[model samples]
Target: MCKILFINNCQLYFIIYISLPTLEKDNEIIDIDPFTVFGLFNKSSMKEINRKSIIKYIADEFNINAKIPTSFNSIPVLNNQNATFYNFIGYRNDSDIDDLWELFSSALDYSKNPTQANRDKVSKFFDRVINQKGNGNSKITMGLYWISPDTFLNLDSRNTWYIYEAGKIPDNIVSILPKVEEKISANKYFDIMKKISEYLKSSASNLKNFKELSFEAWRYSEEINHKEKSKKVQSQRDDKGSGLADEDVDTIHYWIYTPGEGARKWDEFYEKGIMGIGWEKIGDLNQYSTKEEMKKAMKEKINPNGSFMNDALATWQFVYEMKKGDIIFVKKGRTQIIGRGVVVSDYYFDTTLDSEFPNLRNVKWTHKGEWEHPGQAITKTLTDITPFTNYVEKLEALFSEDNDGEIFKEQEIEYPIYDRNKFLEEVYMDEEDYDTLLELVRNKKNVILQGPPGVGKTYAAKRLAYSMMGVKDQTRIMMVQFHQSYSYEDFIEGFRPSITDGGFEIKKGSFYNFCKKAADDIENEYFFIIDEINRGNISKIFGELFMLIENDKRGNSLQLLYSNEKFFVPKNIYIIGMMNTADRSLAFIDYALRRRFAFFEIKPGFKSKGFSIYTKQLNNKKLNSLIECVERLNNVIADDETLGEGFLIGHSYFCNIDEVNDKVLSNIVEYELIPLIKEYWFDEPSKVKEWADYLRSAIK
Candidate 1:
């Protein structure tokens, strides 16, 4: 058994030395500082000491009076508190006491525990004390012990005890015990219980309950003050009006009250006549003087159901510019009232007041929903009047009964316009040839400018039409290319229906619609140009319109499929077709369609004046050399089986200035030209090779 005293902040334990034993030869009693025994100092400061020194220090201080182990069972006293407790049980040797004492002494020297576990335990214990005090009005003392007894053989000796400052112990000792327990005796149990109780009572007296009344009182005061302030703000608003009333005064006040409250107040105000005059009190609002007099005077000016009449009482007074149709309410002498209605028939006013009222003897009165004057004409002025009075007078004179009436006389009038000959001289084109083509366009529906490659065949058609029409806008012309897959169904209307309401609907195509638009625009001419006309399946693409392509059949209506929508090739629309002779695979253009279009060949002309200007711009020696080489090569290949006259190099060959470098020109000749020739003469690679060699030589 060991004697232990557990105080409020510290635990004291003493080992019992029941029997003395001889130590080993090397074991000697050593002296250790008290601070070292508490394990509070650093290891370096206690490096000169050992565990033996610590045990010797404690043993020397207490001498042999230190409590000894015995067969007696006694309860441990934990600092004057009355509570049940137990001792820490563990293994112990004589050497163990020396180790504990040395740890304690070194800790005391450093003013802190040497080990982390001991330091944390001490901190947590103090935290629990502070927290407990913070939460409630209670004080507590906790005790812990590191006990090692000689009888213990293992390491489960650490324990703690909690003691309340209350209660006492029983004294029936020997009688209450079992038979085996009666053999042992313990006399210190009652003393230990008394000490624990005394400690608790002393701790309880120092505690006080926490106060919270100040915070509670503050919250209650703030809530009452907020409610009182809100009531004051609402009361202020009730004394002032929001300005929405319907009185005749210049400054009237309107207020909104709680639903029932407003209605009650309204009834009170009405009884006191505070609401003033309403529209209903004004008199005899529907009397007018005469039928024609009202028509000429006031009939045109009244707007009875207008905004002003809708809320009549909302108007303050009738002081404004007076007009017909104005409902005037005037205050007459003491108890009488009078009302008059203005009747201005036209927008103008005569300003003459008529006192004699027209007779109502011939007029019959009829009852309708509202009051209205009978036999009165409603007068209104014509809107959007033009200032062309002279033009109107002249038109009336031309169709008058005194003269032979004619809306339009076919009288020839001369106007100074651009003379064709002078305009052509300024623009530098042949006037007779231009006018001939222009006349053909005005009379004909279809024309084709068939030419060899690169002769401005398409350009001539466009320029001639533009010059004749004196039109500078490029947007008026519609140009398209004809190919093998181009069809009448795409050009004209087809059964191209859309799924609408679970059924299909046919839609019109572009050509049919464009022609319809052209027919409607009778003053302007429309040009439809087709490039590469020979490459398309012409007869198939034209369909029944092949006959209508002629000038005589134009403007004749033709019915299409799916609907009775008639399509006419408008006379204003001229079709110009451009064909390239290089397209060898193209089928022969139909003879019937060919007769409709006049063919004009456009060939490469090196001697033309335009070609001379084109060549002069190329002043580069290499380009001139290239042209000369191509001309010589063309002479040789002209008689070849796979090459012909149309395949010869045109003046357009020297026009491309993009590839100014020799390397780029070589690539253009090898890649672009050779491939085109190879396609045309696939079975004759020798002739293709010769042509490429000539082109490559021109580049060098």
Candidate 2:
């Protein structure tokens, strides 16, 4: 945390980067004002100072027992009835504090040891908490995170930036936080924290505690905050608005709308895969101003109905609000999921269709197979299941096997790009190198990670996308391997034999598809990662895309030789190419293509603190010695004129210390290490044997 404090008129004024509120000092009150810290917020003025000294000052002045509070209200009462309670946490007054404590404490107790009677109490308590003031809701969440460091990540702009920066949160978690500065309710905050903890535990399973992980998240958030300030200044100069709003990014909404009454028309609906509301008599909703008006009109025309207002609203939504790209699931009497499809067209009234299904929307059916239903039946003809977390997960699972489920066509919604901090935590690379990689990618738009095998080039590429997007959106990322057979026809756009037509058809390649998707959401970033980039004929594969791949040439129209269609690589699409430097058989990338991409050399990360932390957890002397031996071997390899840097073994081979043992080490040495060394010194058999023997001796 950075703070700039200066003395003005003999009064101390503090400008804080991270909040360090105040503590009891010799039974005297010392309170600091609490304000929202934003990514672009800036304060000018100060001297560099130690944060520890500030804490020490408070500690030296007063002595307070360092223990968890016995009761929730004790957090305020024991700390001297100060307004800092409201500043630090969300306690409005004594009465509010008492009321919050009673509810919060009961919920906590129920969570610790829940029973059938109090099973729903946690949800009830969360609802009460969420209904509090927005600022207070956040402040209280921060306090909760502080008390349960093991379970929760703090809810603040800084912490949120960190989580987004890491780009490692699960897809479901990303679904919850779709935009920047999105207000999180109490239940949402808890849900986000739970997911984050689960992710942290999996990624950093070797760690004894999450303290370092939490600090890293905060520190990274601060880093992003600084970057955001710089970006703000640049954006101001560039005359660009702050990208896209949360609503601008299209999302996949799940809906369960039964086709006909009692689902007798389930098979026909499944076959058609269309979503429509049955209120044929209500007429087209575009003519009506409000649901009430429509309902009144419906009453006069149809004469008797039961609970028609709700049905009218559903019809209105089906006609006007249900968007393209929103996913639909047709259900039948809670027994089975009949079909799944995406709404491809806006609602329309088709008199030619069956009278029972006149009000309809076109759907691109992805799956028509029966899937075992997971939840209770939905009665409404058009129900948005996006808000129901449980239902959403179940529906997502039902379509989880679909290979193309993540990517959707153009929609009028916005999505976030990756976060940098999260990328560093996941990839075992130094902060300096990680920051450098990010800069290269930002400036160049296309970056090639070239290094020895096992340097994590491929692993880093996908995560790099996630970190940049700030969301784990697989749809925004596309990966393909380049081989000798890969060609321009395969990469950009080419004519292919049509299976259905029995003739040549113009097929859109992955890159072409990706560019179109990116062009749709020009505000968001998309990633195209190519593995073994040097293995393919770069010149042949890129073709005219070579010109379009350049940053300046982006959006420059060109006529494809095959398709003869106007095409342009979108500005939002970033290219990440991976090349194994040790593969001597492959030629260097074409000079033209090389000039377009920023080349980043990824080295074996043996000296990284993350690797050190990982190895320390193994707590085995032999494992430590093995690392030392590998470092020595790397030095020797680097010194060798014939087998220089490219041939040096990567840390990834030695990173798996979790299952390390004499047998595992021996297998790695004999099979992997020795073979790599032999290839490095193929002309010198004696030298290869010497290094292999020495390597084997270290493992023994």
Candidate 3:
């Protein structure tokens, strides 16, 4: 027998020719040196030789599968008999390559045939599989390539270097890779895997062959390195650039959550500098291998009731789905929103935390204040509100760098308890008017709903406040009618006799009390609505607050009259004042307060879509004709020199579609509109009679 021997780099390699017995017997040893046989190729050629022949030969000697073994019998041998992805060999010596293949097969087919206990087993196995490859092992790439040739690319030191040279990695990853002395960290490896997965799944690029793409990338990277070494000058930055591209950013979901029972620990969360949920019995979610397993654990422990599954699902989302960089909004009680932040760390179980809220994530809170109570309270412990575009826009605005604590400004008024549109329709107001009114209120921070009597100014004012708030939270809203007797002492703070006891107490007026309430809950919005605002002494009742009510002066402190305490109207508090324009005896509003408030004229709403819809629902031809007559009467009233458009008989007189008929219409015409007409044209009795005859004919 003869053995062919080759020697290089202080290591020996021999090719055995055992069957050549004649040559062995003759001692015909070919004395040709292996260097002469192989030829003196440069270091670069040697690297290629090492990559193609030496590395592949070593892998082959270990019986690497031909064309990726489909069955267990065709797989390469595993040195550790019981080696598995989840755990190291544990006393079982009989386990073989088939067991390992079974594990990998389960992982490969995991998404399709998933088991509750093994839900996270695949991800856990992934790390183990990578770790099991040992240092500088290229078999991991081989396995991935075998599984999905089109999806997975090879990962090794050389290929990693290729990717690095291309400058397509995050600075953190770039910083860590070269410093890794033993093995790449699971985080870095997983990050790379995520990047590759994203690139392959991107809809922008149509790439099929991952292997070829990887080879080209490596080759190009090598060329770049060579050019840099030869020229000895800093090269132009690669177009590939570092880190994830804008399109490559993971689809991040924004969520709102209230922690603990009734948000008891919400203050603690903001104080503790963290955001979290309350499910400690389930233990650390990170310890679970799969979401299904975590859910199983939750189902076993948690009270399985209505929305339990949904709550558990939200918990799963919090633990697993919520990645670092996701936005989180914290809701306190049902009225206030606070602590807007970006998740800065992975989900962790804080054992030191009380049982109420132990599952936590680190967050960098960007803003903290009361958001004008957005509609109804956030009921869900965790809710994804990404589907609502308006909420998203508001969220973006709140999180912006220059945002001056403007939170929950715009709100969607779709609540089960409050039928905003129905209320508007009842008041004969249209959606366009409602939106405009809300916008005016939002921008100006102070607004007045002024219109003629019977135009639904008072009715529309409260509904308008509710619509702007997104919920009809009566606690956040207070209504006070201004009158001749209503003074600074009564509207603001003053000493008043207490009814409960025979003593005097310092009484907090409606405005003062409302401002204090607003200040206490700065995270929520409060409304101080004044009906017949012009009926009171405009400058007297408001006093020093007249200047403070300006949008810019909100939150600026001023000395009070009675208590002498420094006070200011909170930014979260919005003032909505109602004025009856037909009451011309009332003094004109102080110009100082006039500029501060946005005056929205509440018209008769005869041409309003709400009125049209209401009339259509009633479907009364006579009533419709009555509306036309009222419109004609309004034109005549508007043309009058004494009684102008402001004094026109409003649609509110004909608004009660449910109650309006010949009798109710006649009563309104005879007792209401006739009297108003008599007052307007007392001198021109014929003019009043003409309009009354016209109105009476419609009711007839």
For model 1, what is the error of residue 632's alpha carbon versus the real structure, in angstroms, after optimal superposition?
4.1
Q: What CA RMSD would you report for each candidate?
A: 42.0, 24.2, 24.7
Please rank every candidate by lDDT, starting with the best.
2, 3, 1
Q: Lowest summed-lDDT stretch of 10 residues in model 2?
A: 38-47
How well is each residue in 1-700 modelled by candidate 1, as lDDT tens digits? 0211111111111222211111112223232222222221112122112323434444555574564332111111122221111111232233333333433333233234336565444333323322321111011111111121111111111111111111121233222322211111112222332343343245442311101111222233333443344234224322101111111111111111110111232333223212111222121121212223223222224443344421231211111111122222111222211111122221111112111211101101111011111112112111111122222222223222322333333222232233454344323234455566667666666777664454556656655555655643232355567777877776675665333244455555545655766787768777777778887788777777777667888878777655666767877777878887666776476897778887654455455555555667666666666667666765764665665665554555445465477876676677666776687678988877887887787767
Candidate lDDT values, in order: 0.39, 0.64, 0.61
Q: Estimate each model's TM-score.
A: 0.36, 0.46, 0.41
Top-lDDT structure, candidate number? 2
- Give Cα distance to truth, residue 476, candidate 2, Å: 0.8
Which order, best to worst by TM-score?
2, 3, 1
Query: Best by TM-score, which number?
Result: 2
- Find the 10 residues in a row with the least total lDDT in model 3: 236-245
- In model 2, which regions exceed 4 Å deviation? 1-339, 342-418
**Model 1 lDDT, residue 232, Cα:** 40
Give the per-residue lDDT digits (tens) of candidate 2, residues 502-547.
7877777768877887998899899988988889999899887888
Of 2 and 3, the candidate ranking higher by lDDT? 2
Model 1: lowest-lDDT 10 consecutive positions: 359-368
